[model samples]
Target: TEMFESDNVDLKKQMQTYNGLDHPFSIGDELLVENSQFLLKMKTDMPNVVVFTFNDTSSWKSDMNIYKAHSGFTLEAQNLPNDINLLGKDAPSILQKDQAFYSRTTYQIIEKLL
Candidate 1:
């Protein structure tokens, strides 16, 4: 996929700058998604599929992995409760370089607009 390869190439350089915290995401990590508490449990084999448990109860699946250059991994919920705004938004095409992070390899979250 050209989109995949292009993002991977672009993010590789960006990820090299950060050393403190891993960027994009980490498994079992809790994040303030749309100003709400959410846990990124795990990544699945399905394309962009991930187990994102919201509030530790209701689990929602969506494309949430930063494979090469995809970012802003969104949930599959139609309308998130509590006025959470996970959908109806666009991930920035290129995240600020300072936001880049490295895991086993360098990567960035490509804006995934819905």
Candidate 2:
């Protein structure tokens, strides 16, 4: 049971009685616990709530962190290898950018987990 303060808003205030966090939760809707780090995995259940699984890289405990319902950030789903290529020459650069974004975000997750 942890609560974090962000933008003067109390994240997890609604989480006190909900025990749904144990299993996979929603994506994009979760607050990043003020100062925590989480490695993004993939998306599940589009539109309603694009949930993404995350790895708690900073933790020695080897636990998975699922960030559900994150609506504020401009997080685009990573294009799968099998997906159609729409970017033409920009594909390589876009993938590289995504990699960098995930890497940096994972680092931030590590800081929060510690």
Error of 1 at 37 (Å): 1.8
Q: Give a tens-digit lDDT track for model 2, residues 1-114.
A: 132223323234323323112122234423233323555343332222222222132343444643433212333323332223655666432445446533222212333356
Give, for candidate 2, the lowest lDDT window spanning 10 residues. Answer: 46-55
Q: Against the true structure, what is each candidate's TM-score?
A: 0.14, 0.20
Best by TM-score: 2
Report the C-alpha lDDT of model 1 over 1-114, residue by residue, as the tens digit. Answer: 232234464344433432111223222322223323332333222222221222121133446732332333343321123122443234322236688733231223333344
- Candidate 1's displacement at residue 82, Å, is 40
Q: Output the worst ten-in-a-row residue range by lDDT, candidate 1.
A: 49-58
Clashes of 2: 17
